[model samples]
Target: MARTVTPEIVAHVKRFEGCKLFAYPDPGSVNGEPWTIGYGHTSDSFLKVRKGMTITQAQADAALEHDLNEVADAVERLVKVHLTDNQFGALVSFAFNVGNKAFANSSLLKKLNAGNYDAVPAELARWNKNDGKVMKGLTNRRAAEAGLWAKGSFVASNTVEAAPGNPIKDLTKPETITAAGGLLSGAAALATGSPAIQIAVGICLVVAVGVIAFLVIRKATR
Candidate 1:
């Protein structure tokens, strides 16, 4: 059976890759390296990415889906053992970040296929260096990926907690207030017996709340 990459996996990859609608060179390069666009899709023989190329959010999303499918296919082809959804997702995200070729040749894959599961995390962490130097972002990403692989869930550790002197008491900011209003409005509409309208409104409100909360937390940490 061919395993499918779940939506959760797609979300995880997107969170790390981020959305760059316009083409930009890799950051660590002195000269403009491979141009990347639309959720870390780099220019290759298969796709021609140019300097001024820009895409809409929908187009970017489509590109991400296509790229992720390719990575998922590669993961399915390479791994020998059965995997959980989270483990599959972690590998997909890793392969997406570090190219399919590197993933195929990695010690992580070797150990995973050889049934040395206990050694996988250390093997995954060994690839945290960029240009032969360790990067903090890469270190965190590897840890998260390894955690997902081992535990079969994404554990969020990115949030900034309250310090000794300062406290973060008010989570009901304007955006959250708007989200609450939306939730209430959806509930009211549901009470009116419009099932379709209520479902749509509820989904929109939930998405809104999620987006608002993510933005607020991200901004606070920064």
Candidate 2:
């Protein structure tokens, strides 16, 4: 399968690039040119980003999705070597942080393409510096990238599994939805006095039914 960024890599990037609802000056920007928002995204990543602009949580998430896709596409286009999902994710995160141009021109890319795969982690580590100075955050990020490069592939990110005998469970699970829906329906049946309460209960029942149907469809497709 073609390699792509995994949720592990997304979580890694998000750990460092915190979300900001309001646009703020890019601290790493030497010239104060681009304002940033929503998990290190700038106007280049999302055109709507500008000074004095605010965004909803959904918009921020959308911007992150857009930016990650752009970076992943760029990584796929530029790199010639075959990469595992983890490797691709690591490079995508690096490229997203350092920009495509820098990544394209870096020795890491050169060494990677030339078949010196062992040099990847070291070369990636060398990129810890920003504007000739080493930033602690950058150092930490590079270390994480190095680890990612070395680590091999694992299971798919969206695989939702519950541990044995766990009390807390995922709400989307079929059993959970069925149980919740049964309780809601019983409560609705018992509340014969208030029409308003029944309406609310009806809405809840509809939502629960929709959830159960969705789970069934998802399972069948899988």
Estimated TM-score per prediction? 0.64, 0.64
On TM-score, the leading prediction is 2
Can you write out model 2's per-residue Cα lDDT over 1-222, one digit (the tens) per residue?
335567788788888778999988898775665888888888862556778989988888788888898989989988999888888888998999899999999999999999887888888888888779998998899889888887874434357753333223444667876787677769767678588887787787778767766666665455
lDDT (10s digit) by residue, model 1, range 1-222: 667888888887887778988989977545787788889877765567888889888878878888888989999999999888888888998999998999999888998999876777798888889889999988988998888888743334558744432113335666567767877776776757677776776787678767766776766666
Cα RMSD of all models vs. native, in order, equals 18.3, 15.7
Candidate 1: deviation at residue 134, Å? Answer: 1.1
Write out the backbone clash pairs for model 1.
none
Question: For model 1, what is the alpha-carbon lDDT of residue 193?
Answer: 65
**Candidate 2: misplaced stretches above 4 Å?**
1-3, 44-46, 153-222
C-alpha lDDT of candidate 1 relative to the true structure: 0.80
Model 1 vs. true fold: TM: 0.64
Worst 10 residues of 2 by lDDT: 162-171
Backbone clashes (count) for model 2: 0
Clash number for each model: 0, 0
